[model samples]
Target: MAAMPPMDDELKALQWRAWHRGTREADLMIGGFFDAHREQWGSQERDWFSGLLQEQDVDIMAWAIGAAEPPARFQGPMMQAMQRLDYLKAPK
Candidate 1:
């Protein structure tokens, strides 16, 4: 298997994934959240967000929108932070 990319590269990849999840709604939700919070994130927070990125966009959206309960592994401060949905904005 190929070696894992460096952490910076991994972060960039995560940013890309956040913005390009195949739908505008998912993109806005995930990508907007990433853009809003990534600067404040430490290594642990980054790791948590990275793990979240591995999940399906549909599931992530469901969790974010409260349409479905997030699993225990995804529950906690980081997910709670996301649950706020503060990153979302009214389109001008």
Candidate 2:
């Protein structure tokens, strides 16, 4: 996909909002992403994910929401993160 316009502080604002609001949507997206890739992540990875700052997860989830575009260098990790987000938000 074409790179999005450089976001400057727009992305950061979104991340901050999600974190302050404690958006369940953000948690679900981040949790689902990690859950879907459970096998790929070793125990340490899982621990790291669990220990991540809520703002960090909010930032990643913000990217998946397309509320912010991730940096081009982060595409691969963002893609993986999105996959997990999709699974978590999928219809039960």
lDDT agreement with native, every candidate: 0.86, 0.52
Candidate 1 residue spans exceeding 4 A from truth: 1-7
lDDT of 2 at 56: 67
Clashing pairs in 1: none
In terms of lDDT, the poorest run of 10 residues in model 1 is 1-10
Q: Choose the strongest candidate by lDDT.
A: 1
| Clashes per model (N, Cα, C within 3 A) | 0, 1
> What would the per-residue lDDT of candidate 2 be over residues 4-84, giving only the tens digit for each residue?
344335333433443344567765665455435554555555444444433466566666767776656445653556644
Candidate 1 local lDDT, 6-28, one digit each (tens)? 45776798899889989999999
- Name the TM-score of candidate 2: 0.45
Against the correct fold, how does model 1 do in TM-score?
0.84
What is candidate 2's CA lDDT for residue 58?
55
Per-candidate TM-scores read 0.84, 0.45
